[model samples]
Target: MQNFLDDNFLLHNDIAEDLFHNYAKSQPIIDYHNHLSPQEVAENKKFENLTQAWLYGDHYKWRAMRANGIDEHYITGQASDKEKFLKWAETVPYTVRNPLYHWTHLELQRYFGITELLSPKTAENIYEQASAQLQAETHSTRDLLQQMNVKVICTTDDPIDSLIHHQTFAQEQSSFQMFPAFRPDKAMQTEQPQVFNTYIDKLAEVSNREISDFQTYLDALKARHDFFATQGCCVSDHGLSHLYADDYTEDEVAQIFQKIRKQELITTEECNKFKSAMLVYFAEWDHEKGWVQQYHVGAFRNTNSRKFNELGADTGWDSIGDFKQGEALVRFLDRLDKENKLAKTILYNLNAVDNDLFAAMTGNFNDGSVVGKIQFGSAWWFHDQLDGMTKQINALSNIGLISRFIGMLTDSRSFLSFPRHEYFRRLLCNIFAEDIQKGLIPNDIPWIGSMIADICYHNAKNYFPFNDSAV
Candidate 1:
């Protein structure tokens, strides 16, 4: 059979094909946000085979298997590699309309030169061939990343991590830059004060200081933030279901932390006060440093406690939250904007109801200093799909200029998922191609191609100055 990756699958749109081959092929990937381990990139680890890379860490497959009534033993349990591949193969035919279908085929075609469809019938041949290539040094972790043209990556890290890998990777690879984001979710773990206190003690030990007071706690976390900065990190990330922006006096906040430290059952109002102050303080610092701050709001995490403990967090146990996110978030951002301390911000929403709200909110703080000083980030996590991407794109376009849009990121734990960018680029090209075909955009190939390149590559480069080349 002929290779599916041959000239035949180049593209349906003549202009799209030309643009990808001519321009997009050479531009390196700037994966600004991801959950990849810096240690793997630093050490340049080699995978055992294709299944370990594709199946071992991919929770997407786990979700699909659970939905198909496959036991956890087959999904991620003690199943052999071939057995896992067999199970995955059996499930593939039913994955139509899911992004996995496109991602699996796209990777096979683009990376492995595979022409045959992946199914129970072709499972053995496909696994054997892919496994063989995986044995070569060319398929090592760093090599895999280079193959995807990844030039820079920012890993989501907690405030407590050592970040030794980030420092080592920086000294070793000038070609690819890996940085850390100072995520302090546990610091705000007010729901579990005991856990929060334990985390604080560990943080204090790491920072080599006593965090007896709230200021000391801030200093300790800020010390790590400064340490992150030395290794070329210019971004901070926060994940919240909604903003906590109620104003509080310094006395009230101090008492709140006192109650937290004392392990007393604090009122919801006290928790809100502490969280609000902490959020404001972080926003102020991020603005002071001229960093890009990301807020991923509207995720209701840890919905199933049993699955959470058995399978651990982020195992498809999170759901869409429906808190009153609008007025509070707008008030918070408005405060920052009023004080001119609102750093370049990116807002991501899980609920589609807030798409228009986020879009309009982004434009509200634009200030006209840059084309995209404020942005509603690409649909993330469960929303990184055709419909989600389209709604987000249309929302941003309707409110602001689509030409200035920054494109997609993996938001994945899997290494092979870099093809997500290709998925996004193709979707973008098709959108533009359809527009041109209908005369909504002119038939000028170069102009439309340039627009496509902007969204896929150049715009993100310009928007985030932390892209390796910018560094």
Candidate 2:
């Protein structure tokens, strides 16, 4: 019998085990960046069963199920819990080398102690066991976080959110630390005038300021940014199809704002200009606040407009978008760096080729104050698989230094996803071991393992705001 968690199991050397897990004090996982629901954490909700816990909110699984010829009725529809679980089980066997396969099995092993491989044959029995465990207090939301040694978690949030649950999480100080990241993507729109106006009104109410135009909108956003700072927020997040670098003047933006309110459509070029200006302004604010900024680029969100209108955001409709990302990203980053406005930053891209782009970009901005100051963030969105992580790690090793890479974020909406950290850890150890064994890397077990642990857990503590300790 082999322990999936055995340190040397993946790396295949008894000596490596002692190095990696030595002081493996996973007391709490500071999930610096994720998309978890604050309301769920606040209530400490226990899942009804496996389907409710695993499938209810996961867009990743939903997309795969849809791709494998399953229907909406069976997925996110009125199918029995057992039926949905069976469908997912059928899909699991197909997920093979995909990150989903590793994540599913690792979580099953970690939380339920069920090591039997998931397949159509074992679906019913496995589902019954998992459902039973998922119903227990040990499998409660907060406990699930605790099971993964997650001590702190930061949830991605929009500018207009009430943050009531964030306040609640702090007041109670549950095992998982829930902080907020200021994501302001919707504010940069030149499309959808009606939605923008409604959003502006909501933003004004949240920040207690009235917005008449562009300047006022910026002011309201600034006020909210300041408020987030007053609490414990130390990161801001942005998501885009690609980087925008079109320069625009304030006067030009003024007219755009007017058209925006009147529900007039702006040209794509003009929209790019406005969005570019907005993103730069946001970078300035992040710099002023000394906050880390995260950029997740290259997602073609909502490709299937028909399904989008029916199921809403993050159903199976989103796919990877192709765009020339490197040049514009350079312009935007260089613009910030030249002004000394670059904060501690993380760059993520869905496309794997950009791994080199991100790694090389980090070198462009390391002004010697910090070693690897700007990080190429964890493999994110569609690219968080073992292969993706390997590509990212290899790119970093070849271009930048992997030892300095701050690695592995769950980026998931599920608490069951904590096993992803382990999956990343194993992959990391194996990469290093293979390198050492092949004489590609030095055979220094203790030093290599220490570096591996740092990548797995230690480095993130210093990389993120774990030292704030306000909660």
Candidate 3:
């Protein structure tokens, strides 16, 4: 009925249209969490073609292409850039009703100003045009970020990282702030002793210490956390199937770590105890330093072992996990809250089923120390789509204060994914507008407009520790 992706593409009414265009659209983006390469941004890397810019490292497209029966070569293998673009274009029309369809065209329209739909018929011409634009100096990595009005980007970095690139960005004082978020999944991975030992050795080397025991290991991690803090990092992230809060004393955890150091197989209970202890230690440090701690849970990753073995992790073989999250998650937070060590926390759940539960969980410890201190983070990963985002916003509004919610993040490796913030803003405004029209809420534009602006940009600006220069 309506023309595709016009100015009012997703806005359903006059109220939605005004809210989006007048308030939400012009807001600067604060991408609080993402997997973007610091080296790429620091070097201002230019892509060779549209394929490199769009296809490479985007597992979302890879998943769609595979569903459309595209082969490995065209998706992630030795195919030429043009070949991959052609394959993706061929698969675009089949993506109708999928969020990728909207994302694909939205990117094309926003970045290249291409209104023509992508298909095999127009693949070559579109690829050549977009690729040519990418080759220009104006389209370099940092330039692309500037074009999207990205104020700050928090890149995921491991505990063992030297953060040399982040240091470089800080020294240069680039237009947009690029800071690292400490992600220490390896530090708590006691189940994989051999691999974890390798990571511990790397941490020890970087920290200039010998980690022969649990306390030393914690010290090494603490040293790196302090280093990250010096570099203006105020966020720590964790990705796990679920949180761990097993009961264990210091002696038990120390013995567990010693067993791991000896490369001995520990029981599942031992693994939980060690992980729980590490989580508490990390939370204490985060609280002490006045940092935000984020937990991204419920991902059943690398399900296709054959594909994972051949191609490696985060190559689109993962799915939402249905793990029992409530008890452990609550216990973990309770432990930190009991000691007054709970830092400003954000919890992101991949499974939609846990939406209401997470919404309720955040309300448990909002001790008025800060507004929305413990937040249910923006709809994440696979749930970053239209319906998923709507559900998350609705649940948060129902059980928590949506006004204080720190809003969207890319959580992506791709530079072009900033438009996802726009998508989220549109959905957010539409929900409020629809409710206002139905007389469920007040029709006060200035007040609601301010709320939209807050969710779009201002909330995160206030929530994060980045200074006035960064915003």
The TM-score leader among the candidates is 3
The TM-scores of all predictions, comma-separated, are 0.94, 0.94, 0.99
The digit string of per-residue lDDT tens for model 3 on 1-471 reads 668999988899999999999999999999989999999998889999999989989999999999999999999899988998999999999999999999999999888888889999999889988889989988899988988999899999998888999988788856789889999998888778898888889888899999989889888999999999999999999999999999999999899988988999899989988889889999999999999999999999999999999999989999999999999999999999998999999999999999999999999999998978999999998899999999999999999999999999999999888889889998898999999999999999999999999989998999888868999
Candidate 3, position 157, lDDT = 96
Residue pairs whose backbone atoms clash in candidate 3? none
lDDT of 2 by residue, 87-162 (tens): 9998888877666777788788889998888999999888989989878888888889888888678889888887
Clashes of 1: 0
| CA lDDT of every candidate | 0.81, 0.82, 0.92
At residue 69, candidate 3 shows an lDDT of 97
For all predictions, the C-alpha RMSD in Å is: 2.3, 2.2, 0.9
Cα lDDT of candidate 3 equals 0.92
Rank ordering of all candidates by lDDT, starting from the highest: 3, 2, 1
